[model samples]
Target: MSTSIRSIKSLVPLLDRVLVQRIKAEAKTASGIFLPESTVKDLNEAKVLAVGPGGLDREGKRVPMGVQAGDRVLIPTFGGSPVKVGEDEYQLFRDSDILAKINE
Candidate 1:
């Protein structure tokens, strides 16, 4: 059976902010050994799904966000506020919370 898609319209982020949903690590390791969540690595990486408009600078000019939706990113282990969306979970934080973006 197929599941219906639910809109994320209500998940608008604030200025200079974005929302991300973490990607779960695979069950098996590089060596192909299956592992559980407890044994798996604590990967805090996520993919950007929604982004806010540019934030106002000291001069009231809009400072554009460096990252955009659909970009894969790494977040600090101690950053962002966790939120639950339906049965899924996501994190909301300021643009500064993004540690780095993955390339390739």
Candidate 2:
């Protein structure tokens, strides 16, 4: 499913910001039983979608971001600005706010 939010097919987030698509928790169990939404744990993992240009530093130098598109990152459960397009939701976070980059 395509989640790009821009009308022109590109969504380059601005300055030190990152666009992330959250990973939804599974609704089924190992034995093929269905689970209720309330029982599912909210996943903290997200896939990097689009990113902005690196932010500038006080010294007039560019500060590099730690995560990039296609990188899997760990995010906090309750923060980040939410974005909704159609019926899907995404998140926007400053690079400094991301918890960590997941290797897998």
Candidate 3:
């Protein structure tokens, strides 16, 4: 799929939802040996592409989200809904579902 931000920007998450693209697993090992595709482990790292407006609180205030677009985040090993845009794969998770923000 086209990895252009333009294509991904077309999707706008809603109500605290986030759209994330997983960071691909490395094809090469630490010693520089090329690992087969089947042996590559899926990484739990992801890049935040888009985020929804914060959800409303009981007091009718908008609760701001902690993570923003362009942030690198750590995700759980499983449980997000998968999304397919062209040949690319993405995941949808709520703000609370995201594990942590990664600092570069």
Q: All candidates' TM-scores?
A: 0.82, 0.85, 0.88
Q: What is candidate 2's lDDT per residue for 39-79, written digit by digit as tens?
A: 99979999999888889999977789889999999998877
Model 1, span 1-104: residue lDDT tens:
12232555577787898888887899898999998768767687899999899689999987898789999998888868777755677887788779899985
lDDT of each: 0.81, 0.85, 0.88
- Give me the candidate number with maximum lDDT: 3
Q: Candidate 3 — what's its lDDT?
A: 0.88
Question: Residue-pair clashes per candidate, as listed?
Answer: 0, 0, 0
Ordering by lDDT = 3, 2, 1
Model 1, C-alpha of 82: deviation from truth (Å): 1.0
- Which residue segments of model 1 deviate by more than 4 Å? 1-9
C-alpha RMSD for every candidate? 4.6, 3.5, 3.2
**Candidate 3: how many backbone clashes?**
0
lDDT by residue (1-104, candidate 3, tens digit) is 33454476688999889889999888998899999999988999999999999899999887899899999999998788787777778998999999999998
Query: What lDDT score is found at residue 75 in candidate 2?
Result: 92
